[model samples]
Target chain A: MKKLMITLLAALVAVVTVSAEVPAGVKGKKLRMALVKEWGTGTHMIMHINGAKSEAAKYGIDLSVIDANHNLAKMAEGIENAVINKMDAILISHGKADALTGAVKKALQAGIPVIVFDNDFAVDEKTANGKLVSMDQYDLMMGLLSQMALVQALDGKGNVIYNRVANVPPTDKRHRIWEGAILPTYTGIKVVNTIDLGTSNPMPKAQTALETLLTTSNNIDAVYAVWDEYAKGFYNAIVASGKKIPLFSVDISDQDLAMMQTHPEVWKASAAVNPSLVGRVQIRLALKALAGERIPRYYSMTPILVKSADLPKERVSMKDLAKLYPAWGSSDAFVEPWMSTLKK
Target chain B: MRQEERRLTTKKLDIFGFFYKYGTILVTIGALLYFSLTLDNFLNFNNVTNIFRSVSIVALIGLAITISLTIDGFDLSVGATAGFAAVIAAKFMVIWGYGVVPAVIAPLLVGVVIGLFNAFLIIKIGIQDMLATLSMMFLLTGISVTFQDGSAIYNFMPIPGGGIAEHTMSKAFLAIGQGKWLGIPIPVYVMLVVALLVHIFLNYTKYGRYLYMIGGNQEAAKLSGIKINRYKLIAYVMSGFLSALAGVVLAARLGSGEVDAGAPYLMDGVAAAFVGFSVLGTGKPNAFGTLLGALLMGILLNGLVMMSFPYYSQDIVKGIVLLLALGLTYYKMKHKG
Candidate 1:
């Protein structure tokens, strides 16, 4: 009877340990993750949420989300709720970070690990509480190199308008990369004008920004906007300007791809990310953080440059989008002991 | 009380009396309940506060339109005036190194100037109010875009020359956009105060009474020896000032100066003002009713968003709701006439 009791007690303890959702050395424990987004110009929000969800399923996690729809007050509320609920972890993306400083600080003090992507704030990315990441340096390099090639195509000499909101950190880094990696090599190209797209919707904002630029200046050799929507503005502006110029940018939307496919001469190329992959990467980071694994203070997404010639024939068909930019659609398995170590 | 008075009081609770008294409020409550039930998290305190905050800007703009419609006149350039004021205020903070006082005051002055321009074209120069204001609308939007060579004004960036002028949007200015008071967004407070003041002015003040009379029937107002043109001038100037005020608040809220920021608000303002007509079957534009209309829109938008409905589809729902409101009020008013 004593031996049977000992065996049964041991089994009960083992079962209890396996069922408990402890953060460290734990797998298959349900993790509650929350995402509060500031804005997503296109399918950016949809893909990002989907990517996080897909990855969460692998980690045995439940995800709840809120979108601010560009309201700072609404965005701030989300952070407050996440902190108040004492969530396992929170991820925030793509918004003015200054507004959420107080709420995010509260979350950090509450011992909730926060993972931020593209939302650099007053705090250093290297924190015990969280990590801040950007698009991969490799992706920045790809975007710069593509810009260089386009400049070279113009015989290393033309009026290049830095059309993106260059002051923004994400675009700022790419601008630095362009200056450091590409511009010094080809001194012939000059930045004639820089577009200041304030806070309008990217579509109309870009169009108006470029249209205004067309009035005083002419002889633009090429335009480089930070994203595909910014590039679309250039395409529309160039059409309105009654002038044709090659346009280069990063980000590939269905609209961007369609425009690039039809107006190849104007909408030249873009450095595109597999948004779904980006989402998965962010979730992987969150999961890793939850598991007490030390992650890099910062990480960037490595994107691929897809030229007009490289895209599929039908930009809007049933054809797989991955075929258009195969380089971006990488499925490199994440190697980690805590990850994929599911409980029996 | 007398028996007759008691009878009248009892009748006040009847269908027509109820509709006349509580129609808009009732519809709004219905919407609130419906959204709270159908959409997850829609009934939460944070979400409800958010809806109010989101509508605050549009509500103020709607208030301005309400005033314009009250005078039997319309201000087509209100949205353009708003956009122009936003860029101007942003430019002051970002480029001119001015304090918040100057930044705000400058837009108000511009609003006065714009009002004078419209008033001149319509009252002095004998242009139809609608046509004149419409012309000013295009001109204002064009000028707003054309200013600074079409690029938006920001703290630091490459200018026309090879040099970069560096500045930061003032912390005080940013606070106006991002600050909260009493657990409520500052914009909501501003909206309420402004709307209430307008309500008092239109309903209680002698100036307001004259303005409403002018809107009701201009010839009768003139026959009563009212300075019709002077009232029209005051009305337009007020409209211009209010439009500029909305612009200033928007700039403060967004933390950046944007071009055409007010462009989208024009439709929203018009919608809210028109929607007010059905509230309580007033069939006329009023501040309180306009705010309520904006509330309806805010609730609808919040509910749709929470349900993960597409942004584009929200417009379809808005159109449908607007059509119902218009059909109800316009049809009822026509029958009564």
Candidate 2:
């Protein structure tokens, strides 16, 4: 009986010791964080916000989301406001680095950890006296995957309609791949037309332009859309024209998924990183940095290629996307054991 | 000696007037001719229709600006009103699952309400037209963002707080933007019909004359028993309705409601209206001139795109052309004064 009692005691002790616990600096603390975005529009941005919000809730964090509405000045001001309010950390998404660098420096000077997604800042730990985590979605890989799919699907020989939006960092990177890698590799693929419509409501403009192109030119084989917004337009134009041109693009949303599934033959494939996963990963990194964890200065999220033929015929939202591709909706990166206990 | 001086002045005025009237038309023709000569298929029938289709929305918005100018008032809210109408239309279809008719008519009603609000602010409160409309612009933009929670509205889109939108954009609505009848784009027909109606209303109607007289001199119009306030009300209402129409067409063309979709048209619309002031030596806003101004811009932009002009450089070209057009009109005015 004494031996059994001692065994029970040992087991009890083991269970108690192995239970999850919050990290030292974050334990029982009412933490505050701010997510300042350049703009919060479209499914991608909304998903990012939703992911961050859900993750922040798990940590009992007071997360405030500030949308600058595509105004750089306002985005800069958002970081300043967070610094003034003395938030625990800051997360910035998509702004001109030049406009945000000074504000980021201010936050760093205040000893606040800053994690930026997609927007590059000049500050480092040595220069800014604080932790700065720069995260990218690996747009280059996204470009390569989508462009290669286009070239491969066409068998490297066809007339193509290429859409380009210049000056934007992601689009610029995508275009660089097209200009340098794809063009050199697929010499048989002839670019019959290049379309660039200024970014506001581009779908309709792209559709109109493509419709005109279809009427004006013949023998077009396929199209490469750098952004899914352009892809949506091209898809619609092709449908309206009753043409059988295949489209390949970057980025994914519930709407884009629906279109792709409905007409897999046309919207052949798209390469994208789950936007919600991006938001969750960002929060994870921010929490890790706050807990005095060592984090790399730069991190990139891997992108996945979603082919239309792979999707089920039934409609699926971003939530359902994970069943088909596990890595897409969930990320294990930057997750610490303490995070499990931090959940409210 | 007095007769000789009068004759010299008349000749000079005639020469200036001739250029003012024909300058925009001549320049448009020169561009068309040049593009036709230099670019492949630039003068194709389909290409010409495409250019008109592209500018159709801008032309409608320009007509809205022109109407506002008739009463010496500028409706800066036109673009916002158009955007607001688009959001409301999309909500009716994508969110509320309503039919096409309500989606179209509801926004027109909203436009009327906006116009009534502008009329009250400008006529009753005696606020400056520019300030009143500018405030409306900001208000509508904020309301639009708030309405859809800052995301665009499309068919089967996932709404905020959960669940997917049920109804997609209807075929009839898409046809308004994407469909063509008799080998011409539908928007081109809409633009031409609206322009013709506005031309008749502005040039041949007593109401248009009263509005112009009020714009020329409000006090003089009031003294002449023209009911200046009533005329100003008419001008603003027309502006609001037309801007809403432009927004509707834009929504149809895109088949989705994007926030600030109509915002880009504001500058182009205003430019077309101002440029119309010197068209045909009218020295004032007119519908035909506004249509012509939009066409000129459309032709130049389309030609530039075909020529492989960089997109960033295209804006510079637009600015330069705008400056040249305005410089001639204002310089002539300055000289006459």
Candidate 3:
């Protein structure tokens, strides 16, 4: 009896780290969480942080934000520190999975729930205290749609410029779709320029890069920027050249809306990730993991395709966004009943 | 027999002297010829103009760095200073909704203050110029991040309060970047004007001579009645002035302020300034040489990109160009000494 009890206790301890399930809810319970970001360079990211703050209020969670400013070592160190501090949960946003994997694994080993947003760790969902939350379906859509935007604009045959930074998870996700799903579909499309807009403010650099491309080759039909800022840079150069080439990209900000409205003819369309909702969703996943609720290893977001023609004459707000994204305000549809681990 | 020997030596010396003086120029012409022959559009008027217009910013910034290098100092903060100026100028119009004068002056004054800050640290605090300016680079870059709250400032940026930004680059400011003055880019003219003026000042003026003297031997210049500190101070301030000026033009050209606007130029400026060392075999920093350096890089970049080379390859080529230029200049200088 004693020997059998020892084996069972060992199994229980192992189970506690990886697959322990909570009874019902942890309402009114205060949990301290840390958010580690690769960089705070985008307005959408700022919005996401704000959403995390406001939405996290309901659960009375105290959030600490650490900005790595796109430094890989700093991002890892931030997660390591959070693990040392024994935060109830830690969420890392938009950092390289490989760089932070060891730190995140260590956190999980400590029985601290590690929730990730938009990082491609490719870790097994059954890992201890680890949850890879958020989805890339929307990002894939961004690529497909951006490609579609180019094809439609070019009347199904034209030269295109491809810009995306490899190793950046979200960018890579969209880029993979573009390379795999879209490029093959459009057999006539020729990539005249390829720029790796790696995780900086892409506007200025893209302008210079595109300007060089323009001086060298004037036969480009359209530009497919991985991000909207890159598109803006390309658009700026095109405008300067007095060319009618249109720009298509992903990500939407207030400035994007304004620029599109002002120059609708030049600006085509974009795939908008409700990063604000994604932020709230990230917080919800953190809370779910904290409560021992069943969470998927990979969660996906549905992106809203915002086009210049479909836009209203005035400025856009959250309510206006809700119409475009059904899951904009609530995280109900993403939540599910208890499951030990999610299958790929 | 002695006269014949002397003539042979002089003739041999002239051959080596010819290469040293005109190697980079020869190379520039060689590159132009190669690209012109190989790339169909490389020598097109519009393409050449584009190349010059694009390098105008690099040329202007390179000129500022050249001033510092001439005085035996280096201002690594030139790029960050440009970023700061760009941020504040954009903020003036896009955030605070101010007019053009404030937009322009705010960044310029900020530049002056930065110059003073760097000057005080180096001159008064007795820190080495490289070390002092290097520290200032960090501070200025951090300030730029804070100014925009770690995000880009564009027209109609979402304010924290509730609404969007209303201010934008006015026509006058946009014209500085977009408009042409008699078919030449305003920036090219700006580059030429600054280069010509600085060239005249450096080669023709006594003050400029004093600066070169201090650069050659600071203690010697100080002992010989030249105020070494004042000239060094002026060199830094001039760097600041021109960095800010470059940022203003960059802002005008970009039509919006970018925090990282000047970052790429740091390496490009370094290359251009070093390339200037070999120009005309001056073996010293000069405005005209720096302009040539900028044009060389501009043509190389324009030609390479027109050939549809990958973006990363462009960086490798730039590295090789800088390496070759510096290698040639350094060995030549060492052998001369």
Candidate 4:
């Protein structure tokens, strides 16, 4: 009897620890979710969409993606439609707060759970009634990590070429960190040149500008790219000039990875958050809210520092990122006990 | 007394004509001299080559706009067509694993097809050139986005559905944009050759005269038995071809195929063409004037950049320069009338 009791207790503990019981209200229920995006064209946005789709599928939730194509009116309409359809949850990405606040408020008033990524909505606990969550890729931390890497690499003293694209929300945040935090602390670092071409295809423009700068001046010691797109151009120019200047940047993608790996000596490091994981977490948070669980008003995904020296010799994609850094591809931030009972 | 007044009037007209004829050239020279005198290394060989190299692509697009102006038609679609060609060429090399010849030639062929379609809309369907090409611009931008699934094509990029794109841009392909001969950038040489050819074609060729005649007076050209529609078709087709060539060079320069990459060139190209109208008092779009216009803008921009001028404010300067050039030409025309 004593041995049997012990075995029974062990079995109970294993079940409690290993598996989550489905909430009685949502058990085997079909849920519908909508992802209204400001734009969904780039590699990062695509991965984010895929992540959301994968997560929604695991729960047998119908996921609809409405790409606004950078039109604010379309994005507002997307939210309004989601509210009219009475979606179980809604996910928003990269939109102007003022244009979306009213629609977000309507969704909240309708009692639909709302999760936003990379956009800050004015609605808070009072407006949302605790059903809204806003999340970002932690642009602040990304900027700090990337700039610190450059500072450390150059021993905090070097003439650097800085690249920036102003007026963008995420980039604005990163620039704040640089201007507010990094530059003041690192006095030894002098910005010799700043480049902002403001063109859609910035690579060629950036390459040409840097090439011109190189001919006129040779005092550049390093390059700091606020976005990896600019870094790619700087990398090309540096290689062409046969210069050994190191590059540090924010953001990562398969193409960025390939470039970093090929010229590890030039592209020293980049700080990034997995966009796919960002999507998955947004869905998870929405589902948790749908399950009547209380969630934070704001959440930020932890960023990872990817160093070229740490990369493997063979070519690798985002899929293989987890093998290099365990925290890269998966996040348990919004995982709920009921999630385990959801269908895969 | 009347004879003396007539002499004064003729002398004044001669002075005005001289200024109208040489105003743009004089301004360009003045800016060049100013930069060379004030800025360090502004007159360096590399810097001069850099200015020419930078404007080369825009100059090619300017030539496209110049051709359309010859037939008194506007092509708002040239920029979009160039962007579409860029994406297509990138697709050919990176997505389909093709060689440089196919990658380059295929987009030029696509441009020709686009031009034919534009001609059909403008000539057969009786739509205005502005409206037709504007619609073509939107359509081509949409098609390019759809073709690439709204993603850039680069070396080792991941495709939309699955798998990695294995083929990288070939060296020969990149060389068209990045290579140099005799210490001159390859694109500069290409631009010079194309400019010379276009200048010759427009000024010296019989077909060129017919096109200009149609532009100057369409009904008169038709009455003179000059196939007006045929010449217009030829003009648009040539416009498309040159725009595609610009796109190809842009792709090579970036070493990637970026969507909407050629859009920014449209305004600059148009500005260059308009500014060309005042060059040597041509009063119409000419290849040599177009090239000069691009060079003038390139010099101003290069000087501003070297001086660490804010990028946002640089456009204001460009607008003022463009306005000045246009103002000179228009003021001359109004006075003449």
Candidate 5:
């Protein structure tokens, strides 16, 4: 009687496994994905995840999603899980490279393709298995654009106050953009002061610093912020102090876009990059590799300026965000999507 | 005979007595002088205003710490409690369309309830103060997140009951955070009143004497017919109440609530308590000394940042200053006769 019951249970399990559809475009195969949580990116992370899920669905791929939640150990665990599950590809939107190195190498040894989005640690422009999904760091683009915006705002000359965050990577990149690119272009745009608002409670700190900056120099024209939150903070201080200042930053949020559309007077402009697009492309590229197609080692997503007048006429709802970008939208990513960020 | 009497009086005065008599005052003056000479922007009116304005929140947190530390109990949850209250106030005022007074009171009342619960855990259940407060900190953080739906609640729209063609809430709110009366920041005035009241309550009142005796020697005070647990609970409750008040003031100042808000004050409050011990050789918590300590930390950080040091490094310097203050306390205590 025990043997007969065990036989019945085994047959049921096999039937259930075979009932699920194999993802399209691939050779009747399943795919696993890992997402790294970058806090402050917010809804964009969800978009990226949705893109991956949608792409997997389109290509006959079963994508297993794992979220790192901005922790390195958790990310590594995701990578390990992907390897153990025999996933076809791994997608990582990392802030630091060192945090995910071991897991990437382990996945590589297991014959899995790793496509890193946004950030990485390798200097050789290659992945753990010598395949590269991204060649250039967005920080470089962010820095170049930030400097150009500052120079233009300054009219090629004035005191530029740089409000920087300590112990963060992108901020360090922005600083480089200020020192390496922006400062050299407009020698007249002298950097009069650089305030470190610290890692935490930057808004109030930036406000207090701006109040002091107003007293220090009447020649200040532009301010550069690494993130939208930090930019908004400095902008708030500038507004509260009643100073006419041009503020620029890297990532743009729904609130930022909405604010730009209605209240353009407050924020001048922001260089916006879509992580959702990156997620979609990362999944597509990973699928192509699984299908034995030659894909580019490095895929670059150019940064675009999303100004007040150019807000998207056709806005994507939070629920359908995954339909737009399948990978980012799946799992718990579905919610009040127009505003809240999905990544962190 | 007169010469001998004068000589005897002069001989009795010792080094510890002189140092203790003028420690906090001397340190404050010395700090001001040192910053004035070294820092380029130290003397500017704008810088001075900025420094005082920034110090207000820390001053409030320091007061919160003082209440707990006086009874020889510690609160690791004050910072988390402040953050929780900020988010709660933001949610009520902005999302629910509540009046500002109700919004502000809601967080404070929540704080009082939390303080009461903390007292219950310690006084009734006999849990240790540090462990109880730490557990409460984690609980409040989860509660704050749940209340806010794990997102920032921003209210940038102007208040509906506008009269003066400006954000009446902004202007009225700004008064508590940024307003000045006779050139002193409003929060500073609030801190001053709180400090004076707490000083009177802790020193002059008979209940205050019992609190001190309980802290000095709990067994002896209990034997002397003191209700030890009741006063201890009161100390913690006051800590919670002040922490919540600080949270509301911070929300008013920032005009929003962040999940990670009120983090820096956790360490800053602890530093203030240790610093008060070294002030005037009090070797214990005192209102004026904690005020000086809070200001001292504020000035040190403000001056260091102005001097172009990174914020991370300022943390290390703060730790060193705290250690030095502890050393001073130990030295004073060891030699006290």
Candidate 6:
């Protein structure tokens, strides 16, 4: 009876010890994670959250979320809070460089590993500061595709309105790439209106600015938005105004793809970033670190150019959309489905 | 003795009737109930803090419009003025490396200059308020674009050999945008302070009494020895100063001046200021009523976002709600009259 009791006690202790699996992705004994600004920009956040949740499962790790909501002050506070909470790792996506350094320093002081995704605040990608896991290479792809689209629509020469997202690093860098590649290549292309549509809520203001431009002159031959969201609004105003200007933009969301297929005036083409791949890679690297393995300072995610013509024929049917993107299954999702309701 | 008792009962009824005249209390209660039940994260500290942080700028801008609405004149240039002030603040901070106090105050002074210009155009040049302010909006936007080189001014990048003090100080400064005061956002407290002061200045003081009387009947107030044009000019200056102050807060929140950061405020200000009509009663714009208006809209936005509703659909919902609120208020007024 005593021997049997000892064995049973040992088994119970083993079960308790093995419950917290040093997850597949976490290299260290524990897991640490952080995300900044998760509201207003719902589409971006949802994609990120989906990736985070999936990776967290593969690696039995605890994830800490901080919604900066695009405020620099609060974002700093969030970073401080995460450090104080004794997180193992830190990740950030921020617009301003100065606002993020303090948080980065705090995390560093706490002896935690930090990885920056989406935007590099103070880290150098080529050096050994911290890995900048990003889709910036996609911007270069955007620049190339934008030029091709512009060329195809304008016949290599005409006035165009570059509805750009100014101040943002990737967007601004993409513009430089576009300018270096396109402006010198196509001399006949008269870049008439280089409107900096600003960063946040670029769409409505861009649409209004476009409408104003149209009223003043009919010389605008094409519209090029830096991102898919801005493209949606610009295309809407163009279609609604009964104008036949060819609209081109980068970044392919499912809605963007649907819009491209249906909008007669919009020739939508975007370089796609496989967020699933990014999530998998990020988790793997983080796990390696936890496991006391040396990893590269920076990792790059490759992007693919996705045209409307090259998309999957299996459209997310009304029935299956619920399973595929459950966030869109809500009744409220259909409220602003204008972007996807294009009847081609 | 029976008649005396009946008279006392009627007096009690009169007090209740007058007190319940404004239906803002009902709307507040409805907002509280709806947010509590609908938002999964509504009760959490994180979400509540987010709400206050986001609402501060709108509240300040709304108050500016509320002041103007009381005088039967609206400021369209307020939004552009905000953008211009933001750029100026960025310029002072980043380009000139000025001290924080000077960086903040310089932009506000420019606002005063623009406001004076606007008041001059309306009061002296005989331009209509709406048309004149609209032109000024266009002009100020042009100035901001020109100064910013058609791009946003990001002043927060680290300098060589500079310690982390630059970054820390800037973050500290930005905390003033929506920092907490006694567990409430600093902007909310600031709004309360400014609103109370303005309310007293407009309602309790003789100058305020004259200002409202002018709105009620301008010619009669002028005939009764009120300095009509002078008071109107002061109102414009006051609107300008508040708009400028709001701009500083926004700059801290946004952390930079993009080309058109303040575009939404133009329409939001109008919507919120006019919402005061349906707040306390039609044809009145009170400080308390403006706060209620901003709060109602803030709650609506928070609830909608929490429910995962798209941001664009908010316009349609707002329009519908505005129509309903105004319709109900008009119905009640008709019944009362």
Error of 4 at A42 (Å): 2.4
Q: State which candidate has the highest DockQ.
A: 2
- Kindly report which residue pairs in candidate 3 clash with one another: A134-A299, A135-A299, A135-A300
lDDT of each: 0.71, 0.85, 0.78, 0.87, 0.68, 0.62
Candidate 5: regions farther than 4 A off: A1-30, A38-90, A98-100, A123-127, A131-137, A216-218, A255-263, A278-298, A308-344, B1-27, B156-171, B335-337
Model 6: residues >4 Å from true position, as ranges? A1-344, B1-22, B156-169, B328-337
The best candidate by lDDT is 4
lDDT of 6 by residue, B1-337 (tens): 9999999988976764443345555766777688778645465664565555556666677777776666678788888888788778776776566767887889889888888998899999989888888999989977887786554554432222442113212555555663566766566666678778878987798877776877788889889999988888887888888788878877765555555567677776666666666765554667766666666676676665444343455567667656655664565566564
| DockQ, each predicted model | 0.02, 0.46, 0.46, 0.45, 0.28, 0.02
Error of 6 at B70 (Å): 1.8
lDDT of 2 at A57: 90
Q: Report the C-alpha lDDT of model 4 over A95-181, residue by residue, as the tens digit.
A: 888888899999999988889998887765677887888788899999999999999999999998888778777878888998999
- Spell out the clash pairs found in candidate 6: A25-A287, A26-A287, A27-A287, A27-A290, A27-A291, A28-A290, A28-A291, A37-A68
The regions of model 4 sitting more than 4 angstroms off are A1-29, B1-19, B159-164
Q: Give the per-residue lDDT of model 5 (tens digit) for B41-75.
A: 68788677667677778777888888888778888
For residues A8-69, write the lDDT of model 1, one tens digit per residue. 45434534565333343244456787888885423455567777787878777778877776
Supply the TM-score of chain A against the true chain A for every candidate structure.
Answer: 0.83, 0.90, 0.84, 0.90, 0.74, 0.76
B1-337 in candidate 3: lDDT tens per residue? Answer: 9999999988977876776788778878988999999988778776777788889889988998999898889988888888888888888998888888999898988888888888889999989888998898888888887888767677766676877777777878777776788777788888889999999989999978988999999889989999888988888888898898888888888887776677767777878998898887888888888999999888887777666565577778778777767776787788774
Judging by TM-score against the true structure, name the best candidate.
Answer: 2
Comparing only chain B with the true structure, the TM-scores of all models are: 0.92, 0.95, 0.94, 0.97, 0.89, 0.86
TM-scores for every candidate against the unseen true structure = 0.52, 0.93, 0.90, 0.91, 0.81, 0.49
Q: Which residue window of length 10 is worst by lDDT in model 3 chain A?
A: A335-344
Q: For residues A88-108, could you state the per-residue lDDT of candidate 6 as single tens digits?
A: 666665447677777776676
